[model samples]
Target chain A: MSIPVLTPNIAAALAADVYDTIEMPAGAEFTPATGVLKTFFDFSRQGGAIHGRSGGLLFRRDSGFAVIGKGKSLTPYANSIAIAFRGTQTGYDWLSNTNTRTVTIENQTQAHKGFYELFKSMRPAMEQQLNPLLRNNAHAIVHCAGHSLGGALAQLAAIWIKKFYGNKVALYTFGAPRVGLKNFALQAPGSVDATYRCIHGDDPVPLAPVWPYYHAPYNGQVVRLTADTGIRVSSHKMRKVPHCYQNSARGDWANLISRERLQRQVFLKREDHHKVTFSEYWMNQIWDALTTLLRQSGGASAFVFGLQGLGAGVHSFYDNLAIELEKSGMNQQHSVHLEGLLACMLAFAGKRVIRAIELTARFIRWVFRQVLSVLDRAVRQAIQQVK
Target chain B: MWHLQRSTLVCILVGLLALFTHNPAEAGMFGWFKRIDVQVSPEIKGAITLHDKPQADMVIKRGTFFEDSWSWDSTRTDADGHFYFAEKTVKAREVLHERQVAVRLLALDYPTKGDEDLFFRLSSSHNLKSRSSDLLTDGMHCELSAEYTMSYLKSLEYPNMDWHGFQSKCRFLHADKVIVSQAELDAAELEETWRGIHSLLAYITQNASEMDTDDFIRFHVRSSAESGLAMLHKIRELETDIDKLNTLPNFEKKFQHYLNKLNKEDQR
Candidate 1:
């Protein structure tokens, strides 16, 4: 018999249950909750090895867990295997989330440094538990689901499961941050059989690791619910709040809004660039503008150029971008917009420099560094909540 | 020889006096003297209630901040469900800084209980120089049924601060009438509107359609009309919310005109 297909609502419930297992006591059995019928593999014993010590006054219990279970009849998919990963639960986890450094993976793809580290830590245990279940049932479908940071890990797991086990894999993530860069995001359609990326309009998690990093099912449609006008930290929460992913993920998937082609941003005027406030719409436009300038400067290779090699990092990449924008005499509009963008960054940092005079390339780079540092602090505080 | 001996004795006396008075806590050799300092928390007078009734004999736990650590104290409420704590002071060498003090009334655990079930929780800073009012010192009447109200603390000394995590379940009797924020009002209204939309969409599909010999051909047309009607109703319900905001589109009027046009088209 064929395996039962999963719906968006069921997938969201499974993802929320992953948090319960994370908080479960060590050596406890994986109890059947949403869709899971029988406990196939519970890596709760390896919980100690993966647990991180508390740092300073934060008093955090840093741990990550994944469970593999057989789906129940009522929930459907008796022949299916359900896997779920929990989101960031501790100070160390938040620390990892904020580490936006990139690392190159296979196929020249790059992923967020912290998320990759978390995936690597849990991969061995996941492989040990999943290898046999997958090998035994050649026809069994693997369903992976998670929320928040766990959503990013679920995406990575989908890629690995599809490649290694060569099984049919379905991936579902809610309010997940961008897991990797362009190449990594592009790899999704080829790896996973189906992808349901559910998100809230105001959710800040899905909007970040900003520019270079991208959400999977790249350029594909998303299940968008609750149309809040701007980005909100509270929207990143899964439960017990308004506009939360859990609350918004209700009802039939077909009834919900799904736009195949997302909204396009207009050209950034130099005069209005400095007026750009901290919002999802403006931030997306600024990121897109930067990406366009990079592509124009040296094709797609420009993105990967300064990202690698000695003394290379995100700072160097921005420095290179600033230099490109300064020297691009072919389009004076782009250069002027870049200057205005720098002024906006300065203004965001409480040092408003709205002069129309042309700024030095070095000064623009300096402004980028300052603004990023402020953003880093803001993210650190925001992560303590739902994001 | 007598003059040289007298000068050497005078120098030795001066050296002895300097060594006796030397202080390591001072900034430099000639630095000003440092003194012991004391900081006091604001006086607290509050009452705790559960389900609108006075909850007497409940343990009220107060955590007073002293430097990096907290000093905790516990007291039971009186028969009338009132609790009181005098001003708490802590002494330290050199200088003392004012800090936050929190109080919570713990509910007896019965299988499953959480922070939300607590009779009261309030946190406030003791430094009056920073803010003119104190939540604890004012007449506080806390009800367990009340939802936690969060407030942001902005300091003139530190501009650009946007922290908004402070929360309290108690009402200050001395305070002015509570002012609701526009953002909060909008969020509540939006939630209700979306909920209504969800139900209306479900109703349209379930009730407004008919099955023909083949399939429901008029399903789209009927659903569209129902959706428009729902939109008009939702807009009318929330019209007052956008009355003052001129930037917002007049969707209620637009939908009314569109529905009338649809009715005209049907007649034609």
Candidate 2:
């Protein structure tokens, strides 16, 4: 993949493309770069349990960072992918992610935990998609970037590409807040020479989560938007993006966040409050219930093949319950209490599996709470020691 | 009225004033109406533990999982490999609006032996009696590695697994369904190639609207860095149309229906 030299204009434009892609509906079949596309069409996403990883795969990718792989299994187009992430809206997810303090990334434990979930989640797909692509394409390069939270994701995505997939990545982050610990910058993927970070004037988002949230040193080129063309962090407005410097690219950053592109946010419309039918709403509710039950049930369901809606409700319920008890740590006191309650419930199930379904969802949750209440103080004290 | 004692009127007025200005210490007067912050105990503390022979690092996701979304609160295990999210005390009103929150996890990479990356999911709730939840038991480490990915793609291709058996296996009534048939895998590979062709056809159909081969080539060119607005629209239109027909219960059916329609058009 051919990427122009890491110029301010090029960085801003790439960031804008990502922002533009973010404005489009996820899974929209778009070819991002001339040789690499940012999104893919997954049939599994249509009916399966929402893996939550599907949507973020769409959008403006780091220029050369597009992963093209034809696995041992032939499906040329299916195998070729670019690891792009969607910027989650400014809501509870963003709040929770930003406030999540710190998390341990792959191979790094103890003192090496990085900050942010949205960034962390970008790791696996990047490895899986890019590893094969890098192996297959000798001239391949990973160009990573995003706008706002997308920028944060791009930072981590490029970091992953640099670390595991080899040193062929160019990273450009626009309006991105600090990602990961201060140390992440010290040994992050891709050198600062190949990285460029841009933020618009008075973009309040970059100054978020305050202290304890550290941005690794921005060693690469740093550009701030000029006062005349100032922008905010969450600005997806389609306008001309002006470079802070006189020599930045000719393209406007607004081209990425344009009004027409924002039409992609249709799927996330909260305005559908008046339009939902009763059945549609309840079906949604039931589907949610089944999916939740399945997650809490087991380590087993994680490996199970697809068995979507209206089909595996009853079975998923029991599987979820059985696995929770088996694989979960249950913590000493909590374990005994759970076992007693479960044993009692197992007796009920022996009489009728249907009886267990009601018990498993409601009764088990109640019992779990009762046990944790007794153990909360202990857990707190133990956790405090670690802290 | 005049004969009534002025002293009585003054005393009654004082009493009314005292009652209206209730003491601040007495539960803030209107505090009973105010919702208290109720504690939500976690039902699952799912952790993805990393192993490197010497020490294990665990990663945990603390989030309120919903039907179509998740609000994450991530945490890492300390030097000793202990990880847990601080239990949240949510407002009672917030609890009233929702039922339960989920914590699901998969390993980043489990280098330690015997410490396989176990897919885990858990829920937390404050108002447990209300029984509110919206979780789908899908996507826990679904896009694992190359083999698993292939296995998954092939399953979609062949479309013949014993759902009841798979369900039973999920429910722990049966042994693991780990061994996928070679025939099935091969069939899936072929189907995947067929799908690739189908996608190419769809790509052509979407781009043909532009009526110029150069523009179309530019649209499909993955790396030609022009603002590909036209390309984005064409792709969105085609995919959005299919997504319209796609549903949780009948995704395959809807997809096949459109595929059939496309196939029919080509014959015409």
Candidate 3:
């Protein structure tokens, strides 16, 4: 029996349809699902306290839904289940998003502490709804999808469905922030059969929870929608705007354009770093260079994995990265390049830096904070425009 | 014979006056013959309330849009907070024209002293001459605390197209059949007006083979920018808070800059 391939247009439409689960009144019978989904079921709920300190999870209600229906127009499988999670809503979700600490999940895979806890809160409700549906139809092809912060939860859900149910799982996420570290990214291919990571070219949400945290399928193949170069708050909107994700994801997957991973490492020269214009390309290149520099220090493992959940580990990581770059043995040229990268980053935050100033861990951390502050403001502004 | 000559002279003068006043290139030469009087707004009896209590002695204003012109009228609620507006009939040259009507109920000197604010609004629109049966069901019972609702309707010009303007937000069943605020409806109409202008520009360009495409686009872009700036200035005048009006000029400048950039791209 052949499984149906999810096309870009259908996946995009479904990602939008899932929002109806959040908008419509509770206990209201949803209008029939779109695309491949025939019947609808709603498990959406509003409030849940984030139990970050304790591992235990409790929720007043569920926050997503599952649709059991046929695949495409015709398929050999008896049933196909498409599970969708709702995006950030309450203040607690925002709090969870900012709590970027890491936690070890099953199989030693490290996941974002906030996202993992969100998934844990809804896991029981999801299982209660999915188990019976799957039991009746064992060969169901599970498709999990979400947008914004919900996309992070959907990724975690996809991994769980694949690990426990032994089903052919496919994942789709739009404008989702980073979920886990390098090891978690590496496990995507082994778990999910296919992943469709779609992002607008100017969306700022996907650029967050910066280095040491990574998006999965690990290879960085994103369906690049529109060629808009600079970040704009309006670009993150999911509606009918031309450069938005929903608008750009209109055509078939076969016809869509994909930006492949940067194969060769990008090393910045003194001139290149000083004159750097802020763009997604430059941001990725700089982070990649910083990762390479850390690796060359022979402490990549210690920095990436060893400091997984420590409270002050985020500051420690940046400080160590600065210290490593400052070492003469790391590379004479690397130190100059590091200074250039810091200058460019500071410039992006609308600040100028002097090379004569000591490259202390505090200064490096402040630069990161300023850059992240800009991104946080952009994300908040985008979120306000959602309705 | 002198009486017959005099009547003939009068007829010729009338003809000359009509020809000069109604140019075929602009208004239709026989516009009077096509003019029809229609009931553009229905008689509506409404009551205003704040926290479910009657709001007395308040002035309510209703602005009606028909035949591409706006007319305003104001009424005051009686001691019982009840008000009534008789049906409005207006002359429309075309039968298929849009009608928009909205009531502004401003509650002043409550919640804080010297603070005047608009408390509730009820706006609706339809293109067809005949009225929507459910436009004002059970009349209008406007609650100041109720959340605003907006609904989309099919386009009058392009019915096949999805999500055209004329949204209504009055709290009642079948509210989707009408529109919300007059300001929003006007904005939507402005979009359609621009769309029409662009279509006319395209038609003219297509027929006039000798016209330079760059020059034509440049002219339209400049005209649009000027018109948009005028509209923004008018809005700023109507706006009360000078601080909030600061963004208008900057927005217009960006809009003009963007249009210029587009013109340049087209030239390429």
Cα lDDT, all candidates = 0.54, 0.35, 0.54
Residue B228 in candidate 1, Cα distance off native in Å: 37
lDDT of 1 by residue, A1-387 (tens): 112235555576567655544433433444423211221222333222222223234453444356666643211243467787766644433333234667765435777666666677677767766777788566667899888777887888888888888877888888888877677777778878878788877665676665566787788768787777465555665532334465577666667647644435334555664566556666666666555555555533344445542123455656666665555543566566666566656655445475664656777677767655544433433444222
What's the i-RMS for candidate 1 in angstroms?
Answer: 17.7
- Supply the DockQ value of model 1: 0.02
Sorted on TM-score, highest at the top, how do the candidates line up? 3, 1, 2
The reply for model 1, stretches above 4 Å from the true place, is A1-4, A25-27, A32-64, A73-75, A92-98, A106-108, A260-266, A298-313, A327-333, A344-353, A374-378, A385-387, B1-268
TM-score for candidate 3: 0.56
RMSD of every candidate to native, in Å, equals 16.0, 27.2, 25.5
Where model 3 places Cα greater than 4 Å from the true spot, the runs are A23-28, A32-78, A92-98, A240-243, A257-259, A298-302, A305-316, A323-331, A355-357, A385-387, B1-268
Better of 2 and 3 by lDDT: 3
